[model samples]
Target chain A: MASAGSMAAAPFWRAAGMTYITYSNICASLVRSCLKEPYRAESASREKVHFSVSKWAGGKPEKPNFVPE
Target chain B: MAMAALRKEGRRLVLSSNPSSFARSAVFSEESCPFGARSVSTQIVRNRMSSVKNIQKITKAMKMVAASKLRSVQTRTENSRGLWQPFTALLGDAPGVDVKKNVIIAVSSDKGLCGGINSTTVKVSKTLFKLTSGPEKETKYVVLGEKGKVQFLRDSKKSMELSVTELQKNPLNYTQVSVLADDILKNVEYDALRIVYNKFHSVVQFIPTISTILSPEVVERESESGGRLGDLDSYEIEGAETKAEVLQNLTEFQFSCMMFNAVLENACSELGARMSAMDNASRNAGDMLDRLTLTYNRTRQAAITTELSEIISGAAALSH
Candidate 1:
């Protein structure tokens, strides 16, 4: 009964999967462009920093000896 | 247990009655004759072509899966970016701070075949190791994911402090990062913690990034109260909580949040890298298949022409 039910729902499952893929792809591109604009401006002036830490502590070292820029 | 037993029984039944497996061995033996050798070679080429086609199908499916996953991961990272900015601004900067000990948190994923994402983090950690030097300079590593763990073990086994691998089994979340943060804070002692991860730039670009979290001493030194009070009193804390204790709790909270963000970014980058890598694999496999099919057709034609010429010459000799 379980196998038969799953088989009957296969097309629905496939459709759901396709919808998910499409939705994510769209969302990703939206976020990417939104992120890219500011990132481009920041990169133009400063090197891209990927690491994140709480800024509550005194921030990064005065002079980063190993800046990968 | 019942499911496992049922699967075993089904597998046994298939193996006992599978005629195709028997026919394959028979074909190999029969095709070893001199007359059938050319045909056998052609058949081998055809088999290879079919296998390559199957692989191409798999890689194409994986590429699609990665593309789908990349979107959600990217969205999560983007949503968290707003929260990240304000907290970082509040912390400000610490200048001329020195470190007694350093901990490097190398973030990566368990899965491979994602281009050079993992290697880039490892390389950055190595570079960090080179830059720090002093009498009290002690460096340790807390690696997330099996790939990073293995690479660190191979390159710098001595510096490895702890490794967590099972985290990548599920989609990354704050709970996981909180647990990790608690473990690092409790077990490790360091003046500064450096997080190394691959920052996603685009579908095709990801760069290794290193961010630092300062310990209380370093923070105190860099903060305004430590002789350079530059608007330190501007923001007042409510209630009767000691500033030190408040900073401690906030540090842990920020660490986990930042770690979660890093994990999300790395996950997105990994998916993007995998999608591109699989796409390339599928294309290469298609090219190979085309070449193999052409070779197989040429071989078959040559065999046919040779047989025809032999038959014609024999007919001519018989008539003479």
Candidate 2:
């Protein structure tokens, strides 16, 4: 009876320990993603588009005769 | 010693024999009649300390919320880049496109305490206007958010055509941008539309940027170029009228997509700026609390010393 009771309690303790470990892993991953650079690097690369008016104009426009609207 | 017990019982300890002593003690407890100077100042300092602590709690909570929000805003901005890329590529290096009238859309948020996020966008808009606009350019302004509107009103009230306020009260979405785009298309006529916004570089850095959304005239100019026209020739069109209609729809879609991307980028920058600002505020509040706590302890000690000396001197007089 003593062996049987101890054997049953051992699995319960192991399961509780496993749950705590999983919780800690989730928390650590979240902190790493928020604070680190690799996640930002991927997003930053996707945002690289050269959209500028000065480039489109091929430099600055000359002094056109002032025509007021 | 005889008067000390009365002083503790919420009564003024007026010693008639020593008029000067009465005057001195009276001056100390003028307002808090029973409590002396040291305890009264200590009470005031304690109240200030508690209020500062409450402020610190609020700022810390704000910092956490902004951090969580920055992540989601950054994701949205990244995802929307694909939608605007092809549109910009098709209108690449537009040549001989002279814009007679230009409209600037300054995108900022209504909230103020978020460091230099809004001011940077306003400053960039002003600079762009000065660089590109002339007496003949007929530049108009469409100011978004109260902060940008107030800034523009102070300097360029005549140029401001329409102002949109309170758009940043909630997290912005594509639907709101579509409505704003529709309003602009209906009310404003321009040769080109320029968008000024803050771009999030990092948690601690943001850059004010400007992007021009080309008008149909500019797009037509680009399509006439030999190099770009060859690129456009790859697409098979059934009719000239159908092509014009399709291009018009594409232009509207591109405008909304660009606006959506700009708002998302600005929101992320705002959150990043607020997070750092609140972090600094919480640190400053903590420093104030420390200083106030030190003052409180020193004042209490001084009061204890004074009271002990008074009691000993009174006992000595009695013995004599």
Candidate 3:
């Protein structure tokens, strides 16, 4: 019976609201899937400044030399 | 069902016994061939049915996967509204840009498994083409999706060149849009421009939308916003001398960001469409499998019942 009701109403639902509803749902799902928080990381170079969104890559830093006067 | 199968065979065997002795021998040869052939055909049919049932299992699994993907994407889409709404509102009816020509950059998906998502965007592109392709100025088309490429294949023959089937490699990032924007802007001969895309509305809906990045039509579309653009024109530039340079830079920046946003929006929509389409397909497969299984069981039971009844009758006749 439920299936019969659905069979009768499917065309109407498709015509009236389902079209927009489906389109909107698809868009909403796409947006929700892509957006994300920025990852955390330390700056790699002396010229670089750390932003909240960045993640640090691990590498050895150069040793500093003391100047003799 | 088993009883029915035995009965059908028993009836056939009983019918075979009614012939004369010589006829019975001939009947055994002729009748046995049909019975064996029928059995073989039924077996082949059963094999086909099982293969279809296996396909249904695969489809059912895909449906579950799509459902999970749908859930995650739905949540992400909901949060994106906060990010985009402010930027779009501030964009405020493309400040009156007067140009002899105009172009609309349309983004669509390369892959199609999504239901009507691609079709809706293509339909909008067609409308835009009709709207702009007047005697006043030539209308140019730039399509970002393969679906668009196919849609406009015939239309490309008309006036201005139509770009179709061009797409960036995946894990689609902002850089791809920048490159696409550069390609578009380089070829653009238009004074005014606009972008038409799908705006994410919900898990099941997307609004076919046109947003003006630059247009003189804003006066026609946004009668109220025209007054605001006039007010902001005075304060928009930094110094008198640098006004042109600053305006150019700002306009380019906004254009790039807007274009990038459109591409991202398109990508999300494509995924959603595919997921939904797959979901529906899988559900249909499951329903078909259920029906086939019912038929298979009935057929198998009927065959079994006929064989059982024939054996019982043979035993009674020997005892008599």
Badly placed stretches (over 4 Å) of model 1 are A1-69, B1-40, B93-97, B224-231
Chain A only: give the TM-score of model 1: 0.27
| Superior by lDDT: candidate 1 or candidate 3 | 1
Runs of candidate 3 with Cα error greater than 4 angstroms are: A1-69, B1-40, B57-91, B94-100, B154-168, B215-226, B240-244
Q: Give one digit per residue, the lDDT tens place, for model 1 in B40-128.
A: 45566667667667767767888899999888889888886665565578775332345778888899888876878999999888888
Q: What is the Å distance of residue B83 in model 3 from its true position? A: 6.7
Docking class of 3: incorrect
Model 1, A34-67: lDDT tens digits are 6667785643332222222221112221221121
DockQ, each predicted model: 0.02, 0.01, 0.01
Compare candidates 2 and 3 on lDDT and give the better one.
Answer: 2
Worst 10 residues of 1 chain B by lDDT: B6-15
> What's the true lDDT of residue B178 in model 1?
57
Model 1 clash pairs are A55-B91, A56-B91
Q: Rank the candidates by TM-score, best first.
A: 1, 2, 3
Best by the lDDT measure: 1
